[model samples]
Target: MDILLSICAFILAILGIAGCIVPVLPGTLLSYGGLLCSYFASYSQMSTSALWIWLAVCIAVSLADYFLPAWMTRRFGGSRAGSIGATIGIFVGFFAGPVGIILGPFVGAVIGELVNDRSDFAKALVVGFGSFLSFFVGTGIKLIVAVGILVHVVADIWVHVVADIWPAFWNWLTNLF
Candidate 1:
């Protein structure tokens, strides 16, 4: 039962990493869930207080993930339409590869600006650049947070699991010899 729970936690952690890149998944939150699973599976390893702290961190990161892109777009002089387009592009680009993912927001922003104001190519380009920068920035933040959670998971496993087993295994081997 412990092993199964551990496996489930590991899978969720992996999915969290993937979520960081995918945009559709709640990367940090899923990673947080993995942490929760690990705690429940091995209650001796981590305290409830520790789990609560991690939960707060995860929630903060998730909330930031939602706002950062839009905030950045506005900071870069992108209009509301540009922000909306970038959002739509993100979902659409998910179907495409990495290249599409990067370009989708940019193209969408430009087109959105163009549609909103047909006479201003320069403005459209500027808005598109802002939208593109926002996407990358958001992606970077999510990646960092997700990776941090995964690292925590690994460290917990090492401390609570391997540390417990290594000595026992060594003792068994010595006795056998």
Candidate 2:
């Protein structure tokens, strides 16, 4: 029973982590759910309160993940055209899949800036690069929080498995490395 439950928890955590890069997945939130699972899976020294706080952090990261790029870009003097371009890029990237999603915003921002700024390459590049940097920052935040939540899950699960005198199995295996 414990093995099955732990497996389920691991799957959720993996999905959550994937969500961070793919943008199509609810990575941070799913990570929180996995942590919740491990925390409640069995009798152990799980810190429920700590996991709760961590979940809040994950939620904040996820929310910021979507908004931070535009917010930072706007703050850095990105034009309205740049902002619209980033939005369109995000959705269009969804259609092109992962690689598309990754590069879509930068391309979109450049094009939008060019159209709005009347062929000014330097200005468009500025907005495009600023948006790209902000996006990386956002991605870093989500990855950090998601990993933290998953770590908590592992720690919580470790306690139960150890107490049960079962060997701790790294379910992530070759996938993690």
Error of 1 at 157 (Å): 2.0
The residue-by-residue lDDT of candidate 1 on 39-157, one tens digit each, is 77754477778778878877877777666655665666777877777777777877888878888888877777777888888988888888788777777877887788777777767
Clash counts per candidate, in order, are 0, 1
Candidate 2 lDDT, 37-141, residue by residue in tens: 776666546776887688678878877877876775576577888887876777787789777777778777877787788768887888878777766787788
lDDT on C-alpha atoms for all candidate structures: 0.76, 0.76
TM-score of each: 0.81, 0.84
Residue-pair clashes, model 1: 0
CA RMSD, predictions in order: 4.1, 4.9
Worst 10 residues of 1 by lDDT: 158-167
lDDT of 1 at 39: 75
State the weakest 10-residue window (summed lDDT) of model 2: 165-174
